[model samples]
Target: MSGKMIDTRVTIDGTFGPFDCRLDPRLCYTKPWFPLAETRKVAARTQYLAYKHGNSSTETIHVIEGRTDGPDSVHLIEGVPGRNGTPAVAVRIRWKGARPTATLGEATADARREVTRKATARRKAARSGRTGAPRAVVVHIDWCGLGEDFDEAAFVVEPSADGLYPVGAPEWRWDFASWWCPACQDSQPWHEVTCPCGLSRPATPLGAAGWNAGCALHCLTPEATSVLVDLDGSARIVDVHAGDTRIDMDRHAEPFGQAEEILRTALAEAKPGELAATGWERAPGRLWGRRYQITFPASRP
Candidate 1:
């Protein structure tokens, strides 16, 4: 496995029925498929046991991770990446029994979710809170109408909030929050908490993360990814610079993370209707799973 890929592989003896495997952290971190250090699994499953009928072994498979009541569900299990950048799996199973109407192509249609016998640790660890070092990022946008008027067209940005401005054209960002305020354009303090008028409820920008989780790596491609944080590790941000644009609504990031310390510091210094982007020159983007660059698009055209 490469350093920036999220994937898992399983091998099973047709007669044994279960496949057990564990991965090195360095390899597993590159994938969104992180599991517990140890896992017991069944690759292929079937309803009827052909061995009892003197034919031999029939394969059966069941997949379940993150428990029945968790938020993360297996969106899919494919043999490879689709036309778009989606998750995939390459599974090889053997079954010598019955006159089943199945082929490799047909098998794709039968993709099933697999379950792990010892999945308790994977479930809990994924939900646990972890803290890491503090990193900073800076976002610079050519904007106008940077304020909190709710109808100002956009919020002010930091680094240089000396002048009022609205962000790029509509559809540029689906939802977002600014480091500066529109009413009084100026750089905001490092720790001021911002409010988000997200899709449903009020999303609180505890710091810089966008409204949607996917936006965490706004400027990064998967090739440079390194880490993936749990849900509680980050907060949501809603940036409605114009209308409903994916580039606009998103989440902000901190280390594994630093919410309270950062939040407390920001709220203490920032005044009402104000904002600023920390550490000038770059916009934030996801790389290897965490936010690493502050001054984004260092190589933009």
Candidate 2:
């Protein structure tokens, strides 16, 4: 499905960075002042959205109005810090047709507050075993435009799941990348891998997640393609494997297995090009204590 296309603008109050304030004769005969200003404004807005609502919430900036540029059109300006040698307060403006008058800062803040409020309420509802309301889940998805060659990544959180739990509760926390010990041919923790052959390997991306267990990047994954998983007998899942993706949630959020169950169901029903958030979970916390289940997408792919 197509995503929402909201208008946006960015502004930079100061003069600096690689931007040339003067008009450039290279791209076009038009003066560079207005174009440069618009560029800085767009940059600022993009950064602000990413910081406030994450990458998914950022809207596409339009240079020209595809529709009629009539009196009914309204413009919204967003202000952002001009870090990285840019303007002090870079502003981006969005021209939308028939919208209320509100500053981007005000709108963004209100939206963020609402998101937090809703997310908190959903979490509370889940904790209290309220089945009427849906459980929240967050996911990282690669969205492709209809005919576009590349994909855009979106990290999003939903307030509820379709059918909360026809699947099951989450009992494991799956890690996608771990280290593989060549000698043992088994997944080892990322920080350190000590093979029975007395061969010690360094940390690698495969097992990088193990660093939280007092494991260093080099000390984590010895082999480089494997990782340590929960013992099969411990959780509902037996073992986690490579190419398998797992859900990471807030330590204080998700009741442990609930998020996993929602993901399991969504994965079971998901079609190609269809990435669902299921709901938002927590951010990554400690690694060892967390249990993970192997994701179907990575497994099948």
On TM-score, the candidate that comes out on top is: 2
RMSD of each: 25.3, 20.3
Which candidate wins on lDDT? 2
Write down the TM-score of every candidate.
0.15, 0.17
Clashes of 2: 47
lDDT of 1: 0.25
Q: Please provide, for model 2 over 1-301, each residue's C-alpha lDDT reduced to its tens digit, 9 standing for 90 to 100.
A: 0122111111122111122222222311222232323343434444554457543334323221212221222222222223322111111222233321212222344554554554565455447653332111112122122124222322221111221111101211111223333434444432235645454543322121122221211132222222223422432222323334323323333322332333343333343533322121222447545444222111111
**Which 10 consecutive positions of candidate 2 have the poorest summed lDDT?**
163-172
lDDT of 1 by residue, 202-223 (tens): 1233223221222223233211
Off by over 4 Å in 1: 1-65, 68-75, 78-177, 187-301
What TM-score number comes out for model 2?
A: 0.17
Query: How many clashes does each candidate structure show, in the order listed?
Result: 78, 47
Candidate 2: stretches off by over 4 Å: 1-131, 137-178, 182-301
